[model samples]
Target: MLISKTVKINQTDNRVESVSCGECKGNKNHKILVSAEMAQDEDSCFDYQVIQCLGCNRISFRHALYEYTQYQATSEKIYPDPKQRLPIEGINLLKPYIQSIYKETLKTINNNQVILFGTGIRTILEAITQEQKTPGIDLNEKINNLVKQGLVTQKDVGALHDLRRIGNEATHSITPSSPKEIKVAMDVIEHLLQRIYILPHNVKENLSSPLKNKPNTK
Candidate 1:
């Protein structure tokens, strides 16, 4: 059970969902390497710990200050996890530099920094348009340029425009984005990444190999 959204530990249970591993690009189970607790009252306490990520053999420290009675907690990332996330060589979209930027966007969202998350998603879109070689004075023009250059279709124009609109809102601070909007933006970007990056890379690999997706005719 990975808690993708929640950051606080369940005070009474002495456990929390493992944080995302930048190296693995997914959540991995963790163990309390060391812990200390202080009781503020008979019914409340705070716990702090150094936890180890089991997946990539990396260590990072985070401490949860929790009050069990009121169910209040605040966390601090005492030591920044210095490990750079390994690129997904399996997908071309995981180019080291670009992938790092995208991962940071994910990290912001995971940490509940809602505004930055919108801006981050917007940056990803800019990266995609750049890679496609669609140049423009601004993102809207760049996206329109993509459609003009035949890199994108009319079918996809709406989604791309919607993503741009969200970014524009964030940049202008028109309104704060809801969690639902962020979730949808994440979905849209991942879909774009998969289609533009992963699919083409996989297609090339398949073409280079004898294996092909053919209809079975036995």
Candidate 2:
């Protein structure tokens, strides 16, 4: 939406940037009907703009603040993957604690809160390690313990460690995550969940038939 700022806003002050119109359900340019300045100081000015979407001709209100020092845009809720409303819906068979954490993570992902997405993925790791009953001093050690238990292969553990590092970076870094990066990570998480929980359950259910006894100790 118009949440990202550009220096050209001063030059283009007459035109309100096109946003994803709720009525249009798509990005469309908007025309400003009024720019009633509400307040101003030496550094910034606030305004309430009445704008209409060019695509659908739907009118909406905009709360804007113009800053002389730097460009500032208002916060917005973004759904980069709207089709993925519940990114972790298939992880239902996982342990409740881990599943809940994963659902929360997906919520953040759906909101396009990049940093929170990473943190949420990291939390899922924590939940998995705990569920596997892997004991260690820290997460790295716990992940290694999971490897020892054969729940996670060594190579997978290495990749999980890398994800852990990236998650840490996301938690601390001010930079936002790109769609491609998060998509790859999301796929990995889904695969891991499938292997660790869903596949095992499927195997158990399929193998529950009466065993064919042969060469018995008669």
Candidate 3:
């Protein structure tokens, strides 16, 4: 369980900063921070000193006995882990699926477009995920940075997002994705390829077959 606390930040104090609270009124200044507790271990850690807010007189307290725990319980539902590992499902298979998507995408575009559209998109996503593992990393900011760096275009990034979302949904759910879902995922890959590469139209016709439908004799 976790709780939030609102506090004022001293300008000299780097810990707390002014922020907007969506639950409260418009642009009201508030510093939001979390305190977490584990029920099984009977352990509690408070993040009170870590941050301060520039807004109201409100100071939030997070504890098992506090309302914050209730908020956590009500706002977010926690489900038990499926006790599953990758290669079986989830992000693990994305690389291969993406590879297949790349081949199709290449057919739609030019040979020179391959590098820009290939594993580059996958690498970008993986980098974001890795950054998110640490609290200091902001995946959104990094994506923005990538755009500023001209390493990837916003259009290409958006298509990558669509593909990642479909892959995630397929992995998390027990029900296998319908053919429709698979196609959508494949489309994301294709879009990325078309946006960056230049491929021959003749090659495109030959590569029209779906990777999932191809027969595997091996």
Candidate 4:
């Protein structure tokens, strides 16, 4: 989600600022170019580009495009097996990009049990549907039940649909797609996965001492 807000820049009054890329910490740079309209004098609109980080390739924007952030609460829906992740196509690796994002998000949450907190339903459903080619009948019913249980929210469900649509298009296109399209799909999948899965269990164990644990943490 992109949100726009005004921030004071260089002592200049309020200027629009928004976070462009969440992972790489890059910002957006909004430059306005004037073009003559046929009926009107001039039209102005903010341009969009991810100001990538030199060291880490993170992206952010200078002008406020609404920032993209994960929802705190989520809905339940199991996803397919990891083997079902989007294809890398030209890349020799199998879903390495997606795996990296999973690890990165896990690190951010600083807990492993939390990994499955928001993802139990999605992971299970995807594993069943994608691997077994089963219909999504009971899966969606479970999702509704989960929503009633407060396992996930409507917004997360919508985001999941959006990500799945983009992923399906990139993977199942009849004609070969451009590298940029593949990259966007991969990035979107990674982002979606990161947002849904908080952190994996193994990560939490390895990051902390055995005695430092707390009850009912996740």
Top candidate by lDDT = 2
Expressed as tens digits, the lDDT of each residue in 1-218 for candidate 1 is 32233223433354544665656667776666666666655554556667667887666676566555544345445355533322234444566655766788778766777777777888888888777778899998898887787767888888888888887887897555788887788877777777777878888876655545655677
Native-to-model Cα distance after best TM-score fit, residue 154 in candidate 1, in Å: 1.2
Q: Ten consecutive residues with minimal summed lDDT in candidate 1?
A: 2-11
- Which candidate leads the pack in TM-score? 2
Candidates sorted by TM-score, best first = 2, 1, 4, 3
Q: List residue ranges in candidate 3 displaced over 4 A.
A: 1-146, 197-218
RMSD of each: 10.3, 13.6, 21.6, 18.0
Candidate ranking under lDDT, highest first, comes to: 2, 1, 3, 4
Q: By TM-score, is 2 or 3 better?
A: 2
Query: Which model, 1 or 3, shows the larger lDDT?
Result: 1
Q: What is candidate 3's lDDT per residue for 71-107, written digit by digit as tens?
A: 2222221111111111111222234544444444433
Per-residue alpha-carbon lDDT of candidate 2 for residues 47-114, written as tens digits (9 for 90 to 100): 56667788878777766676766554343222232134455445769888877887887777777888
Worst 10 residues of 3 by lDDT: 77-86
Please state the error at residue 181 of candidate 3 in Å: 3.1
**Candidate 2 overall Cα lDDT vs. reference?**
0.70
Q: lDDT of all predictions, in order shown?
A: 0.68, 0.70, 0.38, 0.35
TM-score of each: 0.55, 0.56, 0.25, 0.27
Off by over 4 Å in 2: 1-82, 85-90, 212-218
At residue 17, give the lDDT of candidate 3.
35
lDDT of 3: 0.38
